[model samples]
Target chain A: MFNFNFSGEFVAFFVFAVMIISGAVLMVSFAKVVHMVVSLAAVFIGVAGMFVLLEAEFLAFVQVLIYAGAVSILMIFGIMMTKHQEADAEQAKPLHETLTAIGALALFGILFYAIRQSDFPEPEQALAQGTDNTMEIGKLLFTQYVIPFELVSVLLTVAFIGAIVLAKKEAE
Target chain B: MLSSYLTMAAILFCIGLYGALVKRNAVIILLSIELMLNAVNLNLVAFSKYGVVPSLTGQMFTLFSIAVAAAEAAVGIAILIALFRARGTVNADEYDEMRR
Candidate 1:
């Protein structure tokens, strides 16, 4: 019989799992866009915590920096900029919204069923084998993945330019 | 422990999908996409720690996925801004110009 010891790892995992699921629920159910964005930030931070538990420290940092920092802020800005006239006008809508909600619930049910049925590989060993993945990742990225790395840089630059152009106001 | 983490990830992914599909607001859609991306990242890190593969391919793929997600967000938000400017609304239903 397996003893149910409350190890530190188990505690951390439980906390992180609770954080992620609650954040997800908040993100989906919240009516306000800004609240949803905040919930998403929480979810991202929880995912980062999971990365730390998985021994991917660098990925955790990147997750916090990119997803929680940049992406959530950008989403909030988008929401602020967009004018929701319909949302202002109709405080309650029975027909279209009810249909959309039903569809979404059905889709969620299907996805949940698929996820529950999938077989995942069990971790026999206590921990991952080999050296720290951070070092290995750096070496591989610089050596074999150099081209893709450089391409991503170029892509970011292009996206920056494109965003600036797209957001530029026309002169009257 | 693994089962708990996996369940969390699955729930996150499902919520994200529902939000993306049901929400009419573009910003909410974007948030949902971010949620989905994080779900995938969680799975990647989990498998990297637990899977049979000795190498850190899961982490590498996650890095690439993040890069792609960043690029997608930039373009997606820019398009959202443009759509807002053109149509004066960010509802996806209003974007029925392509239906014809």
Candidate 2:
């Protein structure tokens, strides 16, 4: 059933795809919070690989640093504080789980159908060439995307303060 | 090639959606949302590579989205901690204190 051109890049893409999909599935199905976090980290790493394949080295590095590094560790800390090993024993209602599965399946079917129907033209030579883009991305980030860049920094600061306020203990 | 990446992203989105809907734990919900965001990032990068007028636009958008997502996870986990402290549980179904 696998009738297609075989290349080194395609093989690598296949491996990364399997890694990402399996990691996501494990993240969903794992009973323990720690296991889920590990799976999520795996998925993040796989995504970074995909980003690299797409020729976005900066995004790939940032993906690993922020998602696999900061966000997942933050989640683990949350899990530690919330600390509910026995909570895994609790089961979701079967009917609800079934309904969600059906809904997700339906959505996937719709999206896949749409994706197949669309005809995407071959990309530009510059893009299809898949050149190293770290410098270009940085240049654009500081120039054309300056406003949004500054805004995101502000958002991160606000989020930091908000988290501190929300998680801080009340001074009695 | 474009279709394959889009398909992968769609599948990942569905898996994350199912988890977000089916899981009762708040932390799992947050993780599912992250998965969905990751899928979106994949789509953006794929489109940037294969779009009509490809440039750094999609990747730039993805950078912003990642920053925002990290912020969202931090704030969401902070809120979860606050709820866990106040209600003694992290169960989504049990977070009906507002109804009182």
Candidate 3:
């Protein structure tokens, strides 16, 4: 384990970076849907760790609770309900491979150029030192961002109804 | 040190992008998408620590991003299930019946 008090930030960053990369590789290379979902969970956990490093404990906790717990479980259920494990292996095709590659490369190039060319200002001073953001965020969510918060609730409700409708089987 | 972390995240993002684009399997694509999202999250947290934005904003955006990601995963998997039921396959390449 790497240990450096002044270098703690770098150490944490490096650890998170490794976790994310490995998880991504596992997710992409794994053939099984179940394995891919596991990798997705790993990646989400790594992200949560990064949030903790950034001093966002509440966000980190929510990331784990919502993504790793609920979303992943839902994905697994979808995979089981569909039962396409056998068919997935046999239906491979190579169409549009070249086009997609070119497009991805182009996108990467543009992003790299933008990041390289941009001048991001460093912090003049640490803003809001030693403040627990969870309370602040709660207040903002209820007071300042109440409308959007309510809208999100409505959206979630709609999504729930839509999911139920979509999953229901039609009677012959 | 921060540069190293950013490089690692960028590499992961690229690999995920390649997998998402080249792989025919819907499940693999979903995994790749997750990878991409994690890469963004890393960048957001990194910038929040080192750059000018208030830390709370980055954290808040990241929280919203996670919420959006969860919603997306649910809808994506549900759609995949529907696709499998109708077509008997989860390969992206075989989903060409709707192409004009």
Candidate 4:
């Protein structure tokens, strides 16, 4: 209701960014495992929103299907199957926390400075340009990018087999 | 516009990095890694939109990265389950068999 000179895109950006950042913070700081998982899903959904803003509707859908759907379910299953002792949530040492915070802040500062200082070229035309990117991405993925596409499939297969082998019950 | 997107990605990456480095839970660490990968995916898409060439290459790369991340998460969680079975714990600090 607090509408001003705010355009639609900025509103969308602000809403989605707040969702993402807050979810991420909750995911990191939550004490309960289940709460963390839920926050992670929220973050995934927020990421999909950002993808939509970028006009990558196909990627946004995939992000929802894979991350918010499958990956998150898998994570919850992992949490359920594993046992958590009372001591598991013990906080890290203050010194370690301080060091990591410094390191992360330093990295963020460097990235922010570099990105702000550099002159990235703007698209001559909007990338979406009212064309169906889903079809375009599909065609390119099956054509010039087919090799890596196939390789990713193979990688998925390997990971599948490895997970089965590792997670299966051992014979006594 | 591009800079703003990049800044958000950088912030997300740092948050994930901090969690991965300082958190004690193995599962939390894995989640942090996922967060970091998501940041990279966002960066790729942003570049795809804003780059001079503006081809579908970045989007395709993002697709591949998402697939790989899913597979990695599956395998990683599976390994974590196995680790829990063997050691009865999921704390990153406690998985210290190698140090012995």
Docking class of 2: medium
Error (Å) of candidate 4 at residue A155 is 1.3
CAPRI class of candidate 1 = medium
What lDDT tens digits, residue by residue, belong to model 1 across residues A1-172? 1234699987898798888888888877776677778988988998899898888888999999999999888887887888864332334456766776687567657756665676655656645434666777888899989998899899989988998788777567
Residue pairs with colliding backbones in model 3 are: none
Model 1 segments beyond 4 Å from truth? A1-5, A85-133
lDDT of 4 at A48: 96
| Model 2 misplaced stretches (Cα beyond 4 Å) | A1-3, A128-132
Model 3 chain A is weakest, by summed lDDT over 10 consecutive residues, at A86-95
Q: Is candidate 1 or candidate 3 better by DockQ?
A: 1
Scored against the native two-chain complex, candidate 2 gets a DockQ of 0.71
lDDT of 2 by residue, B11-79 (tens): 899999998988877888999999999999999999888787777899998999999999999999999
The C-alpha lDDT values of all candidates are: 0.79, 0.88, 0.71, 0.88
A157 in model 3: Cα distance from truth in Å?
1.0
Candidate 2: residue B98 Cα off by (Å)? 3.9
Clashing pairs in 4: none
Candidate 3 runs further than 4 Å off: A1-6, A86-110, A113-117, B1-9
Residue-level lDDT tens digits of model 1 in B4-90 = 555567778777877787677877888788788888887887777766553477888899899889888888998899889999998
> What's the CA RMSD of model 3 in angstroms?
3.7
> Residue A25: error of model 2 in Å?
1.1
Clashes of 2: 0
**How well does candidate 1 score on lDDT at residue A68?**
91
In the range A1-172, model 2's lDDT, one tens digit per residue, is 1235788778888999999999999988888878988998999999999998888889999999999999999998988899575547656588888898999999999998898787787765556333548878877878898999999999999999999999998788
| Pick by TM-score: 3 or 4, better one | 4
